[model samples]
Target: MSESTPSTGASSPLHVAVGILTQGGKVFITRRFPDSHQGGKWEFPGGKIEPGEDTLSALKRELREELGIEVQDARAYMQVRHAYQDRDVLLDVWRISRYQGTPHGREGQEAKWFACVELPQLEFPEADQPILRRLWLPPLYLISDSRRFGKDGFLAPLERALKAGARLVQLREPHMPLDEFEEYARLIAGLCHRHGAHLLLNAEPESVSRCNADGVHLNGKRLTQYSSRPLDDHFWVAASCHSAEELRQAERLGADFAVLSPVAPTSSHPGAATLGWEAFSRLCATANLPVYALGGMRVQDLARAHQAGAQGLAMVSQIWGANSIERAVTALASS
Candidate 1:
């Protein structure tokens, strides 16, 4: 097996509970008991759902029992399945932003609040992930990402995309020179916002000050290393995540959204293997952020992404691959 490659194996069946405590853009977490399963790890405070109990009702009841707080208005986030040597299981997760009462652990668990942007430092359990992603970003935006922009590029195409109703735009020019790239980014960011779309930078924080972007996009590298709090308040942040661990971290970082890649391997990475639908759903089921599947993805994958609990799809080639922006937007919107 190649290093960094994920193992493909059958999943185990286990029920789990998790909570997302959001206060002033921060989430509260619990340090697991040293004697418990995955002990000493940090996680959202929740537990298994009873056979007849609904997931939300179970979460609500668990929170009140474990933390001494009453939860209200809970929504489904994502579901996750993990296989371990000793045990394998599925976790149904949810997010509750409305709650009452001061929470303290009545169950003898140590609890603390960390700003969402700083969650990497905490030891979070894997099951609480998908819930994190949904809370961190804006609804996912699928857009075109072509490499041919120059003097004759950008304004015309972006305008067309906006007019065709493409809302989320990522100005990622991996091959372009810094100066030329910044100019195009600034140009497109303005056009997107003018059309009432959300514009995200492809991880050039320094350049964002000069552009009218709504947020920044951190590639997996930046997603693993950087914390987002120091950025200007006007700017929101997003990240690219490829795994359950990455998705969890994205949420902890207060990202506005995350791009989850290669649900289906594309022309760009043909040699890359795809995450089969079942595992993809399992991974997505765990994150709390709105996830957009990137890499080798097509408009057809939108329904799959949504059913797996993702907010929507994010694309590059497909958005720019069609003969016209109108075709891509129409297909995406309909999906």
Candidate 2:
């Protein structure tokens, strides 16, 4: 059941520690009791945080009390703040990969495991929508470096990456001519779909529809140009954000996610400023959407990225420059 307490008429949002427990490619979920808040809806299990307690402590206590499982391995996933008519909530979500006991509804709620693909079919509270999107996204976001590899040479590595388990890709060739880029995007889109991967074109918003790509990735300049979301909900809208303001704008524009870049100095932009892990975490804490850490990111940086509150890493050189694309991709998938 949702842990939202009755409205004390307080303006501060209620803080709930939610756990997403996964095993063998499926996630465990429970149905809220019909008499509880957000009743009868499916939800990741958790409860409210008491004063003077940390998030993980509250999470561990909630799961033990509500699901009869001891959290063994877990990490902060994302935070979501949502408002309903009577109350507001701040969901402190965590991803639990290991536990000591099997999960059961100790609270008399119905509990079950479902594959990630099946989650969309269930009804959930409005706040769970962003968490669902985060779950659907892959851990590694591969950004194309067509200019460095050349158009013809790019496909082989991309295909190799896909075969090795790269489910998400961004075709970013900003300098290419519009006509040429569109044509190339069409070919790439077809290839991505054939491999069961989704592709986002880092080109103009219109080009996504024209090229039949899965979505559009807006650069910082393009992000500022849009007063509203560039595409409808059917298409993914991702923006490259460097600061909190840009992240806020992306959220306001209804972007699905964002790539926060320059987490470290990159070879391509050695002189440019970097966010570093500390600053990145600060910015991510304020963001309402999932953020992927980009710039100078490699497979090895994924853990630190997650520690800093990133959904994952978006890579260019680390992927395209790897001596073994398959090995790099496989490592990312396993990570």
lDDT values, one for every candidate: 0.69, 0.88
Query: Candidate 1 versus the native: TM-score?
Result: 0.59
Per residue, candidate 2 scores C-alpha lDDT tens digits across 237-282 of 8999999999999998878899998899999887999999999999
- TM-scores of all models? 0.59, 0.72
> Model 1, 139-229: lDDT tens per residue?
3375545554554564677677678777677878777788877777777777787886777778567777776666778887778786644
Residue runs of model 2 more than 4 Å from their true location after superposition: 1-25, 30-111, 117-130
Per-candidate RMSD vs. true structure? 12.8, 5.2
Listed per model in order, the count of residue pairs whose N, CA or C atoms clash below 3 Å is 30, 0
lDDT for 44 in candidate 2 is 91
RMSD score of candidate 2 (Å): 5.2
TM-score of 2: 0.72
